[model samples]
Target: MTNNSIAQPLEQAKSIAEKTVYSILFTISLSHLLNDMLQSLIPSIYPLVKTKYNLSFSDIGLITLTYQLTASLLQPFVGMYTDKKPKPYSLSIGMGFTLLGLMCLAVASGFYWLLLSVGLIGIGSSIFHPESSRVAHLASGGKRGLAQSIFQLGGNAGSALGPLLAALIIVRFGQGSVMWFSLFALLAIIILAYIGNWYKGAIIPKTKVEKVQVEKHPFSARRVSISLGILIVLIFSKYFYLASMTSYYTFYLIDKFHLSVQSSQIHLFIFLGAVAAGTMAGGPLGDRFGRKYIIWISILGVAPFTMMLPYANLYWTTILSMIIGLIISSAFSAILVYAQELMPGKVGMIAGLFFGFAFGMGGLGSAVLGKLADSTSINYVFHVCAYLPLIGILTAFLPNLEVKRKKIA
Candidate 1:
């Protein structure tokens, strides 16, 4: 064979090996959109359910606690197990739980049934996040941040759509309209089945992957632990603050601005849409710049807007909240990709841990803030939540991570 002919095939092999699978990433992102949209329905219906059931803020808080606990508690174990033994079809199986949850929610007779519905949806989320993260990693083609952002963008966009849909459908037609979302879950299941097929063929088998080289790190185990602790704190700050917005922002607007429920939901949709826009930025920016810098900017940069939100008039409150969502939403993609770099071989575990903690903290924050609102006022809750982002100052403690290149094929 000629030298040029030999070199050409080698180059082509390299190109194919390194090519980013945009098709899979976009497909999985669509699945994420469906999964999170279903989950977001629970909180999106908070106003309607609270009125219908004559629920106090405390009752709302309890419902969140139940759902979040179920979502958060099982994730690590699920990820850890799957890391050892891959389950390609688990994604569709998990979405089935979501399909069932929507049905349960549509016909819920009492608060307990409502709790059960959310709990089932949360369980589906607990399964979806870790495995979907691993799939994104596999399809990343070494562009981890950009890949994560694309994947997360689906989720944030879905979250934004949920409130708007609830306003249009659930609010207009009542709770039974929630069952209409089952069609979404079913669509996700069909798509995820296809992704699972790709996942089975394309994903690296744990046994065959270069486990040792992939996990190489200069930092000691203890340092990695400390850095993880700091990241956890950051997640706590971000999600706790988000809980205030996602769960109670409508109530705050109603109480403070005297807006109708539909109007409040539209504002919530705006804020979450900003969040979706922000999510698309964080991952790629982290890839181009550095995750540490992006982390610092994303987590801390929003503090001023959050602080100003409680004091703003309706016009400015809406503007400030949109800005806050745009700035703050960038943190997760950077944070997740960074942690994956820190412990390269444990992608599933780290995704699970971070996703779980974020959910758990959000739940806890909602419950605590709800009580505080009951005791003081919704205005006070916003004022208190405004301070949570200040905890991002601790980002200084995280060691700067160098991007590690690994074998793709």
Candidate 2:
């Protein structure tokens, strides 16, 4: 009853755990691909949106705000709920809303509807990262870093694929076709959900959860707020550069660098590819090297290379863009991990803000930078962006971090 019986059950539990992790990772990866298409394709569609809507600079910026702001505001609440409950249902619910948003977007009649649709998409995105990440955290056991990195790479891969696929769809089919692709992705998500249900036995389940030593930092809410503030700032700074490539790089390439639309699209794809590679790489590296070091290095790398953009020729632009892509993307991995660590018990809250708010909100920064470009050289925008990472680097010195063992909760 003692030795053999215990070992048998232990081995069986380990096998089940392994299968569960593999299934979750597969599902999360597919969800990420679909989710990324929902968000990242906006940039490819920006020109179409601008032309169709006759949007002003301020309006475009606010469109970004509309999409991101709701996500940011709702994330903490969503996280709190997911933490206390089973998460796969939240994942399905989010995907359902995301699909609805995409369907609305496919036939959007006006600016208000567009904003409403994107906002809904943002809300859906808010659910996936934190909950999926928590699942990954549980499944990984002692290898959280490596596991998180692998899981996060799914997102980066999705992002990389999004722009390139959008560009192809736009070039071959038309801008409207992007919506159809999103629909296909949404269907896939539904299929994956069914698969998850069949494999796991329920979409959501009741299980006994062990009580863990939950961290109770002083003024915990305030600390979360402060961390969120710092992240928002860093996001604003980073996206000024990052979103520019997505939203307006095609325009910039054509107007400034004399590239044709097709060529500009290619360059944008290259840029997205770089970002995807960097994001995939950064997570495991962040875990191995310490998230702090990765953050500082990425920040420091930003300024000098960004400052050089104006001075460089077209070849230099390609090289520098790749370099900047590599360094700056470290933030996606490092900061996401940092924020999750910052709020250990609230993975969804952390991810919601980090992925949803910080990123979604940062969409507005593209407009600010675009406005700045109206008066100054677009190159000068990069020059300004180069220095923004210093804030992130400086924040690295703050003393509130509490790195835990493999399991966060």
Question: Candidate 1, residues 54-127: lDDT per residue as tens digits?
Answer: 99998999899888988898888888988888799999999999899899999999999999999998899999
TM for candidate 1 is 0.94
* lDDT (Cα, 0-100) at 354 in candidate 2: 64
Among all candidates shown, the one with the greatest lDDT: 1
For each predicted model, how many residue pairs clash, with residues at least 3 apart or on different chains?
A: 0, 0
Q: What C-alpha lDDT, on a 0 to 100 scale, does residue 235 get in candidate 2?
A: 64
Clashing pairs in 2: none
Candidate number of the best TM-score: 1
Clashing pairs in 1: none
Per-residue lDDT over 33-133 for candidate 2, one digit per residue giving the tens place of the 0 to 100 score:
66776677666666667777787656666677777676567776677776676555567777777777777777887789889988887777777666666
Which regions in candidate 1 have their CA more than 4 angstroms from the true location?
1-17, 205-209, 212-215, 403-409
What lDDT score belongs to each candidate, Candidate 1 first?
A: 0.90, 0.66
Model 2 is weakest, by summed lDDT over 10 consecutive residues, at: 203-212
